[model samples]
Structure formats: structure tokens, C-alpha cells
Target: MLGISFFSVVSFLLVWELACRNGVVDPIFLPAPSQVLERAVRMFTEGTLLWHALASTRRVMVGFLVATMAAIPLGILMGTSQRTRAAFDPILSFLRPLPSMSWIPLSLLWFGITETQKYSIVFMGTFAPALLYVIDATRSIDPLLIRAARNLGANRWQVMREVIMPGSLPQIISGFKVILGLSWTCVISAELVAAKEGLGFLIMNGKEFFQTDTVVLGMVMISLTVLLTDIVSRVIEKRILKWQA
Candidate 1:
């Protein structure tokens, strides 16, 4: 599988490079892989590429972590209680439909042009979805498990700890992996306006200068970063979900 993937990528790049060289595609619009690599090397040597990547990564992690921390307990509560779910349903309905970009103006007003504003954008964008995922995961737990725990003289808290939490955890983790990727999109929206450094900023800057190679490099960096984070998430998932294996 790895060999096939490698061969496919190599073939695609060869075709792309040849198309540019043969004038079948405009270099200004879509540069060759070699040109994108050159831009990457230049950015790395100038010490901007890593900085931009780290900036975006930091924003994503902070925002995502905060969202997860808040969402889990609340979602569990809502999932377990009809009243709680009813109370929050309207608010979730309102927030869930809104895009990350829609919050930019309010976040800027609330946090100025600071890093907190960027974090807020990511937080707002991801929090509702993460909460919904957790709620669903929690609610998916078998009623029989809860009843069995209760029959064994387990209290509310004990039942939750022994039955609901364990039952829901695997699905929650899977949902969180997806939300982590969504956080990247939120961070990009955050950076596009007020950020001085981030892949989104790098891409916008490249566009203003008509440096298509730099723009492509920025996109590639985002994809590579997301891929790296997904690998890490998979490792962590394995560790946490050993029972599943």
C-alpha cells in the first residue's frame, strides 16, 4: 500500500512538472512541484515557514483543547438529562449553523487584534460541533448497561463512571479526531484577517504578491501539518483505546 501510494504521488508530480515545462499549464497559475519546493526552501532558510506553522499549530491546539474540556462534561450532562438537553437545544441550534468567519468581527471586538481573538475564532467554530459529537456519543450508550449498574447498587456518579463514560469514550475519541481537523479550518479563518504569521497569512501574502509557488507551498504546509497531527492523534487513540484493539 505504501509503495503504491508513493508511486501514485510520484507519477502525479511528474505529470504536473511536465505540464508546466511543456506550456500545457501556466506557471503563474499552477507552478511545478520543483518551484513549490524552491519556495519552501527559501521560506525555511529565512526562518518564516516554521514560525508560521508553529503559530497556527499553537492556536489550533489551545483552542481545540479548551473546546474539548468544556464540551465533554456538558455534553454528558445533556445526554443524561432530558431537561438539560432541552435547555441547550435552542442555543446549539443557533450556534451550530454559524461559520467561523462570522465570528471574526465579534471576536475582534472582544479580543482586539490579539492572539486571543484568533483562539476565540477557533474555539467558537469547533465547540458546538465537538459538543454535539460528545452528546451523541454519550447518548449512544446502552440503556441496559446503566440499568445493570444501577441494579448492582451503583449510585448516579458510580453508574456514570462505570458504565456511561467507558461506553461513550471510543466514539468520543473518534469524533474528537475529526474535530481536530476542523479546528485547522477555523484557525485559517482566524488568521486570514488579523494574524501576522500562520499558513493562512502566508498564503494571503503570497497571493498579494502574485507568488503562486509560495501560495502552493503554504497550502502544502497546511496539508502536511494536518497529516502529521492525524498521525499523532491515531497513536494517542491507540494508547487510550487499547481495549478496542
Candidate 2:
């Protein structure tokens, strides 16, 4: 696996460098791999690259955590109670179709071009769908398990906490993994308006200056960061869901 990964990356970089060097692709439109790497190195030495990457990462984490924290409980409640489900269904339906970009206007109005506005955009974009995923996961728990828990003298709250929550946690975590990726996409939209530093901002700024290298670097950074985060999430999931795995 390590060998394959190394070779694949090496081959890609080689082909990319060759393509630009040989004029198969225009450097102005798509900067050479070396140019992008040089920009990355310069940015790193200057510290702006790290700052932009961290800013975007922080936004994604904060928004994703807040959205997950809010969604799980509400979703569990909706799944467990018919009344709650009925009350929330229409609202969820309304919000679910709204894209992240749609929330930017209202978020900016509410938070006024602050970091909070960016976080709000991501939260609003992710929350509805995340809640629905949790609800579905909760509902999919076997009714027989609930019945057994009740028969064993578990109260409603006890059953929810001990039986339902535990039963649904694996799926909930999996859903959050998907939501985390979505949050990154939302971060881009969030930065589109007024962000001064973030991978998204870097990309936008690069475009205005016709610096394709910076734009490419921004995109590559996003993908690499997402991959790293995915690895962390998977490790956490494995540890948390040890019993199931």
C-alpha cells in the first residue's frame, strides 16, 4: 500500500511536470507543479499559507462540531417521538433544499462579516441534512431492542440513552464523517464574500491576480487537509465503536 501510494503520487507529479515543461499544457492557465510547490514553500516560509489553511480548518471544525452537536439530539428526539417528527418534518424539508450559498446573505446579516458569519454559513448548510441522517439512524435501531429494554425496566429516557443512542452511534458517526466533508465545501462559499485568509480566499485572490499557481495550491491544500481529517475521524470512529467493529 505504501509503495503504491508513493508511486502513484510520484508518477502524477512527474507527468504534471513533464506536461508543463513540454508545453502540453499552458503554465499561465495551469502552472507547473514546481511553480505551485515553490509558491507553497514561499507561503510557508512567510507563514501566510499556514494561516490560511488553519483558518479554513478551524471554520470547518467549529461549524461541523456545532452542527453535529445540535443535530444529534434533535434528530434522536424526532426519531423517538412521532409528535416531534411531525413538528420538525416540514421545517427540515424546507431547509434541506437550500444550498450553503443561500445562507450567506442571512448569515452575513446576522453575524456581520465576522468569523461567526462564516461558521453560521457552514452550520446552516449542514445542520438539516445531518439531523435527517441522525434521525434515520436512530429510527433504524431495532424496535425489538427498545421493547426488550423496556421489559427490563428501562424507562423511556433510559431506553433512549442506553439503547437507542448506543445503537445509533455508529451510524451517527459515519454520517458526521460525510457532514465534515460538506462543511469544507461550505467553508469555500463562506469565504467567497469577505474572507481575507483561507484556502478559499487564497484561491479567489489568486484568480483576481491571474496566479494559477496559488489557486492550484489552495485546491491541493484543501484536498490534503480533508484527507488528513478523514484519517483522524476514522481513527476516532474505530476507537469509539470498538465493540461494533
Candidate 3:
């Protein structure tokens, strides 16, 4: 599968490069693979690309960790206590569908173009979904399991810490992997507001200068970063969930 995937990507790039060289596709619109690669090298040499990518990565991690930390405990409470769910569910529903872009005006006003605003964009975008994922994961654990824990003389906190957490963790981690991807998207929107450095800013700046190679380079960098993070997440999941297997 890995070999096939590599071959497929190489073939596609070959076709793309040939098409551009033969003028079937305009370089202005879709630059050759070589052209994009050249641009990548130039940016790397100048150190701008690394800095931009790092900025976005930092924002994503901070926002995602904050959201996860807040969501897990609250979601566990919501799953176990009907009254708690009732109190938060209404507002969460309202906030869930709202895009990160929608909060830019208020975030800008509140945080004034600082990194906090960028992190807030990511946090706001992912928090509700993460909360819901945690809630569902906890609730989906069998009630029989809970009863068995209790019958074994486990207290509420012990049942939660030992039984509930382990039972629900696989699903929670899976959900967080998705939410981490979402944080990257929100960071793009975040960097749209007065950010001088980030992949988002790079793309926007390239557009103003009509540097299609830079734009494509920014996009490619985003795809690579997301792929890297996904791999890291899978590694973490494997280690943590090895017991289940």
C-alpha cells in the first residue's frame, strides 16, 4: 500500500509537470511541480517557511490542548449527570455550528490581534465538538460495566478514574485526532486577522503578490503538516490503547 501510494503520487506529479511544460496547463494557474519545489527550496533557504509553519503549529497545539483539557472533565460530567448535560447542552448546540470565521470580529476586539486571539479561534472552533465527542464516548460505555464496578465496592471517583476513563479513552483519543486537524483550519482563519507569520498569512501574502508558486507551496506545507500530526496521533493512540488490543 505504501509503495502504491508513493508510485501514484510520483506519477501524478510527473503528469502535472509534463502538462505544464507542454503548455496544456498555464503555469500562471497551476505551476509545474518543479516550480513549486523551487519555491519550497527558496523559502526554506530564507527560513520564512519554517517560521510560518512553526507559528501555526504552536497555535494549533496550544488551542487543541486547552480545548481537550476543558472538554474531557466537562464531558465526563455531562455524560454522568443529566442535570449537568441539561445546563450546558443548549448553549453548546448554539455554539457548535458557528465557524471560527464568525468569531473573528469579537476575538479581534477582545484580544487585539495577539496570539491569544489566534488560539481562541482554534479553541472556539474545536471545543464544542470535542466536548460532544467526550460525552458520547463516556455515555457509550455499558451501564453494566458501571454497575459491576460499583458492586466491586468502587466509589464514584474510583469508578470514574478506573472504569469510565479507560473504557472511553480510545474513542476520546480518536475524536481528539480529528479535532486536532480542525484546530489547524481554525488557525488559518486566526492568522487571517493581522498575523504577519503563518501558513495562512503566507498564502494571503502570495495572493497579493500573484505568486502562485508560493500559494501552492503554502497549501502543500499545510497538507504535509497535517499528515505529520496524524501520524503522531496514531503513534500516541497505539501506545495508549495497546491494552485494548
Best by lDDT: 1
Lowest-scoring 10 consecutive residues by lDDT in candidate 1?
A: 188-197
TM-scores of all predicted structures: 0.98, 0.97, 0.98
What RMSD, rounded to one decimal, does every model reach?
Answer: 0.8, 1.1, 1.0
Cα distance off (Å), candidate 3, residue 213: 0.2
Residue 69 lDDT in candidate 2: 91
lDDT at residue 127 of model 3 (Cα atoms): 97
Most accurate candidate by TM-score: 1
lDDT of 3 by residue, 1-245 (tens): 99999999999999999999999999998899999999999999999999999999999999999999999999999999999999999999999999999999999999998999988999999999999999999999999999999999999999999999999999999899989999999999878667989999999998888899999999999999999999998998999899988
In candidate 3, stretches whose alpha carbon ends up further than 4 angstroms from where it belongs are none
Q: Candidate 2's residue-wise lDDT over 140-219, tens digit each?
A: 99999999999999999999889999999999998889999999999998896779889999999999999999999999
Clashes of 1: 0
